[model samples]
Structures are given as structure tokens and as C-alpha cells.
Target: MEFSNTREFARSMDKEDPLATYKDEFIFPEVNNKKVIYFTGNSLGLQPKSAKKYVDEVMDDWANLAVEGHFYAEKPWWDYHERFSEKLAKVVGAKPPEITVMNTLTVNLHLLMVSFYRPDAKRYKIICEEKAFPSDQYMIASQVKFHGFNPEDAVVEVKKRAGENHFRTEDILKKIEEIGDECALVLFGGVNYYSGQVLDMETITRAGHEIGAKVGWDLAHAVGNIELKLHEWNVDFAAWCSYKYMNSGPGNASGCFINEKYHELKEIPRFEGWWGHSKERRFLMEPEFQPEPDAHAWQISNAPILALAPYLASLDMFEKVGMPALIEKRNKIVAYLEFVLHQIDEEVESDFEIITPSNQNERGTQLSVFLHGEGKELFNYLMKNGVIIDWREPNVIRLAPAPFYCSYEDMYEFGQILKRGILKI
Candidate 1:
């Protein structure tokens, strides 16, 4: 797939793209009374046009059916979340019973840790990457402290080589072995939010299990963006938000996966709620807690129908196209974006260092660019000129060419705008 840095070439690629029609499914943001080139699906994805229709159905049910909507609504509010299990299972490569829709990302992380992060005196340490998303860092620290252990002593951070910005798989594996007997859990982000580096989850999971540690992942940035097989990888548990690549609306409900091996283990500790009880016996109001025999047991409350509706809209698109097709377009468009950026560097003599891995297998659609000079000013100039990318602290600009909606022309336009911005600075 050779790429040329020209508008005609970009338009030719777009004309040939199989996923080009998907761009119409979303509503792009307007800047300066014109549609901006959106490249921040890694942060907040553009909204699906069908989202309003889905939410309206729920609203109509509540307005007309009122209390009866719990059982009599179009989709039935009582079991709304259950509808997503099969679709989501396909997305993550798991059994339907192994996946469930529930609370927000970090909230689900804490709930899963309650069951998987059993820190005994002999094996009380946790292994994770340094500079994990701040929420994960906070959650790990709090969980360690909850067990009456100092976070500094119980949490081991695997750092990169002095000059590198991303973690090496070998280094992470060595750290897992180094912490051996004292490790209780090995938790990591499937894709680093800042550097956009995808970790080797299969190897990490196997290594953690050999060392007798429960392994989990925060897949917020990886779920819909990359191919995942949580069950096949033997991942103990995982959680992800739908707002990013999943393209659900802002602050949507999250998805969680619990390995089938843990499904029947009733003795495991969890913060239980009535919603997690067996639905067959829920109305009987039994005094004892009879947990569901699957990942559904993790639910602490009934489904948030409105929040879950938007996700259902997005999942409909995923089910129709499947992940294979989406990933194919992702690789091609990202390659074009990479080529265009390199062309810009050559033209302007800019020292733009791409911090994300060059290998396609080691990343998703995102490329994190470390700007060498006038970073903030150039970033601001791009924003003022109607390009929508994200800026991280210090000096990194993140661009994600989401396959579902982003076009090749957007990539070419971004390159042109980026060159102008750099020259202005």
C-alpha cells in the first residue's frame, strides 16, 4: 500500500475505501462554521447518528409505559443490559456468559479487583507499568493501602529503559519474574493512553499465571480499536469504557469480562447487589443472595437504560461490519497517516518524533507525536485552523484515524495544516 502525499492521491484512496460509507453514520463537530477533521477517537469519539433514535425509544417507554416499562417497554428496561452481552462477546472474543455491561470503567476495575486481587501476606505485591493512566495508578494504590500495605512497598512499577518512552515486552516479563512469589496481581492497560503503545497481553497473561498472579487489563483504549481475545489470552478479568473507540456517547456505561473459570466460584468476595442475583428468583425476594452463574453477577445495580442505549446503537454497526473489516481499514488509513506525517517532516525540516511503535501489530490507530520545537504554539495553531487532535502534557500531540469515520482525505488535510502550523511557529 504505497501512499502519496497529495490531495488527489488521498481522494483516490478514499474512493476505494470499503468503510467510506461509515463516515456518514457519525455527526462531526463544527469549528468556525465548518466540519473539523476529527482525529481524537482515542479520547472521545464522534457520536453515532442513530444514538438519538435509540435514546428516544427509552424515553418513549418511560413517558408512556411508566412503571410498566420495566417489563413492557419495547426492549424491556429490566433486562436492557443483557442485550449487549452477545454482541460484546463477539467484539472481545469471549463467550456471551463471560461478558457483561455494567458501571463506569474505573468503578468496574475496583469491583473486579475485589474478587481477583486477593493479597495474602506472602503474595501481596502488584506489578504494573510506570505512568499508567492516573485512574489506574490511583486504584492500585488505594487497593494496596486497603490491605494495610504501603503502596510504595507493595506496588512494583516496571519502567522503560532510561531514554525510551514505551515499555519493552521483555522488560515487563522480567519484572513479573523478578517479583515472583510476592506478586498478587498483574494489572496493565492493554494500550497506553499517553504513548499509544499496545502491550503484549497474551505473553503478559501467561507469565503472570506461571508466577501464580491474577492478571487483568484496563482495555479502555484497546477494546473497539484493536483486536482482543481476553478469553483466549486467559486474562483473569478486564474492563473498558464505550465513549472512546466504541463510539458511544460521553459518560456511557462500560463493559466487563470475567473469565469463565471464575463464573461458578460463589465463594469469591464481591460487593454484591440485588441486580446481580439470579433473575429467575429476583422477584421472590429471598433473604439469601443467589448470585448469577456468570459475569452478570458483577452488576451492582439495574441497567442505566439511557446510557446503555447509545452503546447499543454503536454495537449494531460493529455487528454488521465485524472487527476484521474494521481492523483492515484501520491498518491502511494509519499507514497513510504515518506516510503523510513523514512527508511533512521532510518538507519543513521539523523534528517530530513518533513515540508510538512503528510496527502495526504493536499499536492501534493512534500515533503520538513528540513535537521537538514550539509544541504548544503549533498545537494551538492547528486547533485554530479547524483540525481536531489532542495535546498531552509536556509536548505530545495525539492523532487517531478512526476507521469507522475518519477518511484518508482527513489525513492529507491534517498534514497540510500541520506544515502551515509549524511554519507559523
Candidate 2:
């Protein structure tokens, strides 16, 4: 499967792509009456054209049913979040009983921490990857402080080897061993946000459990972008936002997976709320709490149907095109993107070092490139010329060519645009 950087070659690939038609399903932003070649699906996914219909249904329900919408609406508002369980379970590799749709990503992570990150007198340390997404950094630090421990001591970071862009699996296991009995929680982003490196979650989880530590993942970048097996990996918990590769609109609702092993365990403490209560006893409003015997047990508030609407819309798309097809396209498309980058680098005699792992298994849809011999000007050029990508600090461009909507032609088009930018043609 040789990749050539040519319009004909790209179009030939597109013609043969099974998922190629999906590009038409999304509404892309226009630049000079032309749709932009989007690559920032890692940051925020383009709106699904069907999303408006979903939102309209919710809005219409609110208008027509008023107070009775909870029970009378077409897709009843009362148990709307329940619609996501099986579909989301398929996405995250868990049973429906272990999946729940709830608050935004960080918010869900905070609530999950209360139940999983219970640092005690002897075991108070938390092990996480170095330079984790800033939100996770803040969450871990704040959680550590709330438990009356210094974040510097209690929050241990498994760092990459000096001069390396990615954290090695051996280094991570070694850190867990070093932390040993003092470690109470081991948390990491399933896929690193910066370098676009997919961490070894199965091995990490096994190692964490060996040390009597609770394991969790912030799958913000990993969820829809990569294949995951949270339950098979024996992960204690995991959370993800729907706005990125899930294509659920900006700042939409989140999804969570809590291992069913702890479903009704009395020893495990959770910040329970009304929605998390038993569905049967919910209307009873008893004075005591009896949580749902599933992942919904962590829900702190009622379903945000409006926010979850777009998510359900996207999940419906996931159902149509299962993960296997998406991953197949993802592998080929990402390799083509990498090949294009290399071709452009050679043609323009410019330094474009992709910091992302060369191995397809260790990377998702993103190629976080070190745009050497280029600067902010190159990023600006691409954006101005109808290419949408993400720029990180210093000099890095995170180009996540989402498979569902992004095409092989986009990779070729981006390469041409980049060549022109480099040569100022």
C-alpha cells in the first residue's frame, strides 16, 4: 500500500473508501464558498448535519409537553440518558450495565475521583503521566489538596525518558513499582493529548491493581478516536467528553464506565444524587439512598436531554458504522496522512518531524508534528487557505484527520497547501 502525494492518487483512494461518503454527513465550515478540510477533530468535531433535527425534537418537546414532557414526549425526557448505555458500551468496550451518560468530562472525572481516589493515611499517593492534559493536572492536584496532602508529594508523575517525546511502558510500570504500597490511585489519559501517544492501558491497569491501587483513564482524546476495552482491561473507571471525535457539538454531555464489580459494594463511597437512585424507588423519594445497581449509580443530576441530544445523534451514527470499520479506515487514512507529511517534507526540503508514534497501534487519528523550519505563519497560512488544524505551544500542529468525516483527498490537499506555504508560492 504505497502512498503518493497527488490529487489523482488521493481521489483514487477516496473512490475505493467504504467510509468516504460519511464526509457528506457532516456540515463543514466554508471558506470562500468552499468547505474547509478539517483536521481539528481532536479538539472539536464538526457538527453532524442530523444534529439540528435531534435538537429540534428536544426543543419541540419542551414547547408542546411543558411539564409532562418527561413522560409524554416521543423520546421521553425522564429516561433519555438510558438510550446511550448499550451504544456507548459498544464504543468503550464494556457491558451496558457498566456504562452511563452524564455530566461533562472534567465534572464526571471529579465525581468519579470521590469514589475511586480515596487516599488514606498510609496510601495517599496518586500516579499519573507527566504533562497530562491540564484539566487532569488541576483535578489531581485539587483532589490531593482536598485530602490534606501536598500535591508535590502525593501526586507522582511517571515521566518520559529525558529527550524522548513519548512515555515508555516500562518506565510507567517501574514508577508504579517505586510508588508501590503508597499509591492509592493510578490515572492516565488513555491517549496523550500532546504527543498523540496511546498509553498501554491494559498493562497499566494490571500493574496498578497488583499494587492495590485504583485505576482510571481520562479518555478525552482516546474514546472515539481509538479502540478501548475498559472492562476487559479491568479498569476501575473511565470518563470521556462527547464533543471531540464523538462529534456531539461543543461542550456536550459526557460518558462514563464504572466496573460492575463495585456496583452495590457497601465499602465503596460515591457522591450519590437523585438521578442515581433506583429507578423503581425514585418516585417514592424515600428518606434513604438506594443507588442503581449499575453505572448510573454515579449520576449526580437528572439527564441533560438537550446536551445529550447531539450525543445520541452521534451514537446513532456509531451504530450504523461500527468501530471495526472506523478503525480500518483510521489506519489507512492516518498512514496516508503520515506519508503525505513525509512527502511534503522531502519536496520542500523543510523539517517536519511528526512527534507522534510511528506505530499505528500506539497512535490514533492524530499526528502531532513538530513543524520545524516553520512557525505560526505556516499555521496561519493553512487556516487562511481553508484548512482547519490545531496548534500547540512552541511549534507543533496537531492534525487529527477524523475518519468518519475526513477523507484521503484532505490529506493530499493539506500537503499541497503546506508545500505552497513552505515555498511561499
Candidate 3:
């Protein structure tokens, strides 16, 4: 489809957008008595209007029912997390039993590593992308140290070639083959946070398995923004936070995915809690740990209902529109944004370059613009003008036109504001 830099063309596209009505579902921040143009869903999603309603329901239940709310509330607190299974399964493309909502992203990553990252003497190395999210880097390094291995010796990183901004899939596959015998695990972020590159998860999983290693993903950016098939890909395990593309509140509860094949294996080691015990035997308080026969077995505590409530509100929207439909709108809006940026560069004769891959398949909603000469000045200028985008270290501005709330006109207006900022700089 062709794109134009004109405001009227963008407005026309917004009018034709099938998912345009979803804009009203979210509450945006205002600046100078006007709604800001928000494009930071990759960092923090705008809150959905229904989030307040769902959270209020939980508060009411707690107020009215007290301790009996576990069994007597409209939606029982004891099983609050269970309500997300089907909805989250649909979002991540897994069997309902294979998915469970639990602790934060890094905590779940550590828990999953306890079970999957069994590094014996012969196979002690783990392969991951260089410059992974700090939490993941810390988790992998700490886990390697816990197993009595030095991080520098035990962790293998797939890095970009000199002068390149992203890792090539062939290079990653070759690295998996090169470290074949010693690799115990291959863990990577499904969508890289800095460059916004989406990895080839299925191929990575296959290659890791062929090398006799377990494969997992930190799907913090991929979970709600892109289509995933963890079960079909045969991924060993994965985890993600709800606040980014999922549009849940800050520090919300997270979701985890474990292959069903691992469910019935009683020998798998995990840090246990009562919530993970079989539901029938849970209240009986037996001494032995009787794990649930699914992903819930990995849970370390009971659900945080207030945190889970806002997530439910967002998941309901996902269920209503479905991922395919959401992604369809996402692709077009991102392309339009890309087109608008290119036009701004040409008009202003600036050297801003997009570091994120141009291929739609290799990215989600984010476009990481490398501000070659102009630094945070341009970003600050835009922010002052109520154009909300994110700034990373060095000199990159990240903008994500989330499909649910951001409209095509937002992209057009952003481009105009960016051009004005560039001219001033």
C-alpha cells in the first residue's frame, strides 16, 4: 500500500482503519491541557479505561467479603490467576493448561531456569544475544555463577558484526552449531528491547534442540505485540511482563509458558509453593509437594488479585479483537510511521537513520530511530511539544504506535512535530 506524508491522507487512513474504535478504550496522558501523542507502548502501555472498573471490583470484593473472599467473592481470590489461562493461552498461542499467570518477568525467568537450565559438567554453556535486557543478563550471569561456572566462560553471546545494527539469523544458527556439544541452553528475548529486532524463534528452537539444548524466550516485548506459537514452536519455556504492550498497570503480574511435555515429569526440579500444589490437595496442607499437572506447578505464591485485575481488563480486549486483527493494524501503522520519518529526513536534510529492521516480520510496532548528529535535543524538543516517545542511551529515539490506541493521524502529527524540532535544532 502507498503512503503519503499529508495529514489528510493519514486522517483518511485512520477513518478506514477497522480497529480505530479501540483508541477510545485507553486513557492517555495530557500535557498543556491537551492529550499527548503517546508512542511508547514498548516501554509502558497506556491504561485502558476498563482497568479502573476491574480493579474497583477487586477492591469491593475485599471490602465486603474480607477473609471469605477466597471462596465467596464474585470471582474467588483463591483462583483469580486461573481465570487468565484461556485468554493468555490465546494471546501466546499455547494450550490453556500450558500457560499460567504468576510473578514478575525476571522472577519467573529465574524459576524457569531452576527447572530448565540444568548445566552439567560436559554441557555447561548457555547461548544468548549480546546486550540482552539487563534483567536477563543479570539472571543468566547469576545462574551461571550459582552453578559454579564463570559467566565469561559459560555464557556465549551472538553479536552483531562490526558496523551492523542487528544479528543475522544465519549467524545465530551457525553460532548454535559452533557451540553444539557444550551448549546446555539457548535463551533470548523474542523481540530485542533496544533494536526492536524480532528473532526467528522457531528456527532457534529447532537448532537448539538439534544441538541437545533447551530453548526458552524472554517474551517481554513479543507477547502481546506480535503473534507467537510457543507450543507449535516447541519452546521449552517463556515469560513476559504485562505492562508494556499488554497495557496492564505498572509492575503488574506476569505470565509464563511451559511445554506440556514437561508437566507430567515429576523429576523436574523447581522451587515449590502451596499455590502450585494440586488444587484438590492444596487446603489439606500435606507435607509432600504434589505439583499441579501443568504450568501452574511452577507458581511460587498465590495470585495478586489487584495486579491481575488490570491485566484481565487488557486481555479481554485482546480476546475481543484477536491478535491477527490487531497485528494487521499494527503493521500498517508502523509502515506509515516509517514512511513519515523518511519524508521528514528528506525534507529537513537530516541524517536520522532507523536502526530497527525494515522487514515487518523482523519487528513489532517499534521503530528505533538513530539520531546521527542530533542527540536528545530533538527528543526533548518533541517531548516539550507533547509528543511522547522514548529515549535510549547514546542517541536513539524509540516510538511505538501501538495498534489498540494509537491512530494513523498520531503518526502523521509526530512526523510534522519531528520535522519542526529538527529544523530548530
Clash counts per candidate, in order, are 0, 0, 0
> Which of candidates 2 and 3 is the stronger one according to lDDT?
3
Q: Could you tell me how far off, in angstroms, the CA of residue 211 lies in candidate 2 after the best superposition?
A: 0.6
Locate the minimum summed-lDDT window of 10 residues in model 2: 264-273
Estimate the overall C-alpha local distance difference test score of candidate 3: 0.94
Per-residue lDDT for 55-91 in model 3, tens only?
9999999999998989999999998899899999999
Q: lDDT tens digits, residues 137-235, model 2? A: 999999999999999999999899888999999999999999999999999999999999999999999999999999999999998888999889999
- Estimate, for each residue in 198-309, the C-alpha lDDT of model 1 and write its tens digit: 9999999999999999999999999899999988999999999999999998888999999999988999899999899999998798989899999999988989999999
Q: How well does each candidate superpose onto the true structure, as a TM-score? A: 0.99, 0.99, 0.99
Candidate 1: 10-residue stretch with minimal lDDT: 372-381
- Best-first order by lDDT: 3, 1, 2
Q: What lDDT score belongs to each candidate, Candidate 1 first?
A: 0.94, 0.93, 0.94
Candidate 1, clashing residue pairs?
none
